[model samples]
Target chain A: MFKIFDHTADIGIEAFGETLEEAFEETARGMFAIITDGSKIEKKEKRKIEIPFEGDEEILLVDWLSELIYIHDVETLVFGDFDVKINDVLTAYAYGEKYDRNKHKYGVEIKAVTYHMLEIKRNKKGVTIKVLFDI
Target chain B: MWNGPLIKIDEYRYKIPESYKGKGNNLKMRVPAIIYASEEMLPSIKKDDAPEQTANVATLPGIIEKSMAMPDIHWGYGFPIGGVAATDAEEGVISPGGVGFDINCGVRLVRTNLSIEDLDRKKIKELVDELFRNVPSGVGSKAKVRLNMSQLEDVLHMGAKWAIENGYGWEEDLEYLEENGCMEIADASHVSEKAKERGKSQVGSLGAGNHFLEIQKVAEVFDKDSAKVYGIKEGQIVVMIHTGSRGCGHQICTDHLRVLENAVKKYNISLPDRQLACAPVKSREGENYFKAMACAANFAWANRQMIVHWVRQSFENVLKMSAEEIGMHIVYDVCHNIAKLEEHEVNGKKMMMYVHRKGATRSFGKSRKEIPSKYRNVGQPVLIPGDMGTESYLLRGTDEAEETFGSTCHGAGRVMSRAEAKRRWRGQEIARNLERKGIYAHAASWSVMAEENPDAYKDVSQVVNSAHGAGLSLKVARMIPLGVVKG
Candidate 1:
């Protein structure tokens, strides 16, 4: 599950899950929450993106968010929902829309996903993570 | 974190209360952390969360005086951008965070005889193209001139001297470089084989993002005497080289971070930030890191030297002038991220301390023996680069800088995050926009261009103004970018 906060420019997503995969989905949702007002972006624009990491699970999470950020920058698309599966690596099929400058009131721009404040823990309940975006 | 009130020392200076001191923070800090900034710059400093970083640095073992922040302060990994702190030599700890990922990421100025009158759109474009071609750039970019293990060791030890010996630049250029473009204490033996492997082929490359080569013209002369001393004249053309040791430096930092991280536990050193992991200066770990870091610093100086050599060659080829006729010479080379062992007066006694300047420049004022004889009277030339579209500044160290441990702001600090700048700006449009302003833009990637857009940084004029007001560096000559090459 994920809770979204109204940050000035970027949406802040707080996610909790019983597994790393669930927490990652919430993180993706957080990124989308800031891209478009939840009310504006319907789950209409859907696409599949499966990202493979060269390193471990922690770096995989960063790479996953970095991929979405890259897609946002290169394709000019915004996603609202995320369904991610972590089997050895992360594979995600997400939903979003083409960024309409006229319609989307841009929030804070996150430059690069930093390792600062990045944590993924394997607790008794499951895995918990907190990542901050540099806006 | 300190829970006490922030005591205002002056309009530009403030202190964190003693009540904020945390356990495991040693060194008997003489005063609370101090930061220099105008009213407007303070908000960005706070918003960037650099103040807490400053407080965190104060918690380092053997920290002395006060943890300080410059006017251009912003959030960096372990230390705040423009953070400066010194620790007792025999006991103080050295952190890789104090240096940064881009070890020896610095700026160098190349003075030229050609003026604005000699450069038009076509000529400038031709020059930029030549520079981009001759100078290898971009991320994961390989060097055109490869070096084997032996050659790499020479570079690690000899630094810019190796470049000069290999016919990269003239001997006279060495005089203008910090430590003569080579730090003498550098020990390649201390550097790991993996770091050497990474550095072997990466010399003379510009690498990527924020690293650039810009063709600029002298736009304004603030201190004519200092400008003249620096061989900069009004309207003269110049090439500004901004880069570091590239992969070598990055790998060096990475390698050291691991060593220091483990050292933290081995040495039983307590630090507030994991990124600020360190070991005592006299300890085996500290000496090892210093020696290796010096090698990295040397490699960085050599990297810039090779780039400068190519820049000279590019000018000669494009302008159809011999190197002599082009009259290109190095004005200065200065380092921003490093920690060096030096002796400074503390409590009426001279004490050896390890000065860690993360995003700060060593601005030793006049009379220091380390300064070149030519600049000994006016102090060392401090190069401060603005963004591509805005103006860069040339400054001289002020006497007050010596009081602050020979430190000064490095550049116009980033104001907007890269993502924000990209969202508001189109890379192609920004490139075209520079063209309209009579400036040229050549970048390896759109992301790089957008990240380095002039708007992403604060107004350089204000940054310089604050530096002057803070008594760090005196403005000399301002440079305007004519043609820009970004990686």
Candidate 2:
């Protein structure tokens, strides 16, 4: 599950799941929700994403979201879902198609994923992750 | 969250002494920090973590004078939205956060001979729709012009000159822009291929979020002499373009930030926040980032120049008059987010320093050689745009602003979050309200209208008055939007 929070000038997302990987996937959904309503996006095509571990889980999470933002900006694709596997490296598959402005609707165009107030937490309940975007 | 000591320094100034080392840090502040705000504005300025961020900026190594923030201060990453910092050229460090993600995210104002009397409500709507059609905007907005890798490199190097040479605008327009629309230090090779790819098709486009093109009428004139010299008169029509380098600039900032983050550890430099990632100004990493940043800045200049061309075309198409015949001329363009290396006087001594202005404006006073020769006696024109359904102001730089390294406020600044605004207002209702106010607005997304609800922002007049009271910038004229195109 995911919820959106905000600051005075920007917005952020917090996601939770039974596992860290699931939390990552939910966080990706929260980001897409900010971009659009997220229901119209279909898994028309799949792009395999691989990111080498950057030393820590915090940096890795940022890399994951940034990679998606980069892909969204350059390729004009919007992903509503993601399948992930995390080990020494992060391997994932993003599912979406070329964005149709009329069909999908317009939300904020995020400039980049910011590291400010980024967090990853684990407890008895599960795992929760939070991140903010520079709009 | 930051309840640190703030000593009142007269009416428009507050000082955070150097003794406050912040909450947690081994790095000591090299210089004191000052925020130019009225006594009544303190609560909101301290509402978020912005003041702490301002304090964090003071801790940067080799910082010269005081780390300053304008009256429009708000929370931002690394530096407050209206933060300004200057550091010694040789020994100080340069941070990517200080420049913000949108490098050269700036404003450009163009004037026309036509006034409100010449344009009716119907005419305003037609022209606004024409502009919306001509200028690509909103999510996934693509440019009308496309360039291959080689041609894109020329744009990175030439900036607005590339646009003018390509028949996008008038050649004389260059004279009125800050830095003449090109940073000669820009090297295309320093920019990464990904950033170039993102930029290639995005040129001549306006990205979403607070970026807009507006047709406004001069509503009030404060200093008639300065207003006349700047080619602005009460009741005259004008166009203001607010946008930046788009994805190209974002990618460049992100890539460089990663490098600077690593360099922080390598250089053994200590910073209170990791986002303030930087390297010594003379280091290879710092030089490379500066060159690449200049490319992004040039891209933004070229982007604005192309939009200006489209704006002219849109007006011509709607009114059946050539732009030149309509007397459409650029007044001045100012950058809001950038790090520039220039010479300024420090305590009565002249020295070169790197001035970082994030969400701030460069307000060089009269007699500065950097300004256009035409406005030498009155000083450079500073464009301060207001939020939707609000009044924007035109101000002039004051020599007194030198205390803050010759800078002033960028905008009214956000007083609330986008989500809060979105939750409270309906876009369609906001549009209806804007129409009632005699302002016609066309937006790509209804949701954006709600997010940009005028109430979400501070009262611009108060912010402008604070700057005027402080003598950071002097009021020239005020403009109220007649029509707006939002992305």
Candidate 3:
């Protein structure tokens, strides 16, 4: 499932999902889609990163985004994909990377993520995450 | 949730009707609700559900005139973040959330003789480091000033005056403080012993979450005359202490909210939000809460006073100069989260009313005798602090402020929630990033650091701009943060 929604003044995100891993991937694609038009970027580089959290879903979610924020700040990279695997003990191994401005065009700058509408609801078939961003 | 009538007042102001009576709205609202904002800001205001909160506040038992919101309005728990409502003294109701959990959470301005250029970046860095060490910060941070039960009561009742008598601050400082550093009616007996104990050792300490001790340099002066009168100049160093009554205030609000929640049903007062639970001003519950909340407010004033003393000490210890030699003096202190009894024009008659300002500051204009004599001619100085990386502002109340019950926006209200900020950013790296930007942040924990990130707040410039644009306040000077010590 993929959907685009307006968050605030100048931000729009496209939420995507097929699997749990696919959902995380979709969140990043959605973020870049909001930040810049990600359709312009070709799949240039694939980077691998591992994130460990206490065996809790909430902390896992926090750690995942903290990692992304670190990458964005330090390397000025906006990842377009999230291929996450939740292994034993709630560890998440994810791979993705830098969104080239030349390759990917986007819209309003996302200052930060907010917990206003944050949720990860699990149904019989799968899970869905609702997140709000500050633009 | 209720959309009452939209009463068009003027270009910059509008009102919501008082017709939503007996429908969970509490006020016997005599007048419509008033909101100040531009067309651009209105969408965000509506998004936060602020209008509903304002309308709900308007429905309070004895609310006088409109439940007012400033241009920087945003959605907040019970009362909208920038909401202000004044109710008749005998019939008005008081709610904890209206004053917030942090009672008397306020801002104080301090001026120094030295210009910003006199303190090199290295000196400023040292000053900030010293402040971080000297002023205990973060969650549950203790203070050097320990007090017994009796001494705690003294602080509670005396407020900043207690600090002065104890040699923590100077007597002259009292003049610059709101209520002379004391709210006279704060009965120590009204404050629970538990609240007293929690506050006993917390004085002179900076509490956590959006609370800070900042060193700022004035960068712009918008009103030359007012700036001169305020002793503010371009490149001048000033300190802004922003915190509140800490655990004492929080416990007081918690305790009272429980009491009010029970009494509201007894009083047959209906409210849209339980957070808006209140009791009539004449009721015992209401009186007790007011006295107790006043004690908390005084405790907060004392807390900030003691912190200001330590801030001076930090400057003295780090700079190797006596505080007297450095000419460190408080400019003014103003409370944001509070409800106070004041006289206002109600139905063409001067009536005593309980003014509830949750995330709003008093912006009394010139000629309001309540303002200090020094500023009586220029209006009260309204201090608005921005984020760690940006500039804060010094504004003065304008004559137009009377239309909004002498109120203004408190600070750059949060744009992001804590959980979301933590999710989006790493504390350690964020600290490092700030360092690269020539800004240093000393926080007790990362949890708090992420919550108070610059992006977590609205553009304070926009907030101040809206305030000035609306004539509620006039900008005096802009101060850029030199360093931040957060708790």
Which prediction has more favorable DockQ, 1 or 2? 2
Ranking by DockQ: 2, 1, 3
Ranking by TM-score: 2, 1, 3
lDDT of 2 by residue, A1-135 (tens): 999999888999999988888999999989988998798999997989999986788778888888888888888899988999998899999999888878898668989888888899999999999998888
Q: Chain B alone, TM-score of each model?
A: 0.96, 0.99, 0.95
lDDT, residue B449, model 1 = 75
For candidate 3, the TM-score is 0.77
Docking class of 3: incorrect
lDDT value, residue A133 of candidate 3: 54
lDDT of 2 by residue, B1-487 (tens): 5698799999999998888867664537778889999988888898887878898999888789889989999999889999999989999999999999999999999999998899999999999999999999998888998889988898899999999999999989999999999999999888888899999999999989999999999999999999999988999999999999999999999889988888999999978887898999999999999999999999999999999999999999999999999999999999999999988998789999999999999999985889999998988999999988898999999888888788999998999899898899999999999999999999999989999898999888888999999999999999999999999
Rounded to one decimal, what is candidate 3's iRMSD?
Answer: 13.6
Reference-based lDDT, residue A72, model 2: 88
List candidate 3 stretches off by more than 4 Å.
Answer: A1-135, B1-11, B19-30
Worst 10 residues of 1 chain B by lDDT: B22-31
Best by TM-score: 2
Residue lDDT tens for model 1, B1-487: 2233456777667777545654344433344688877777766666656777787888788888788998888877778888999988876788888888678889999888888998888999999999999998764456788799999999999999999999999989899998898888888888877677668777998876667899999988988888888888899999999988765676567667666767888988765666787888888878888898999999999999999989989988988998778888888999988888877778789888888888788887886788899998899999998888889999999778866788888988876765566678878888989999999988876656776788888787877788888888888888999999987
DockQ of 2: 0.81
Clashing pairs in 1: A9-A107, A9-A108, A10-A108, A111-B419, B2-B20, B209-B487
Better of 2 and 3 by DockQ: 2
Task: Compute the lDDT of residue B413 as modeled in candidate 1.
Answer: 81
TM-score of each: 0.82, 0.98, 0.77
Residue B207 accuracy (lDDT) in model 2: 87
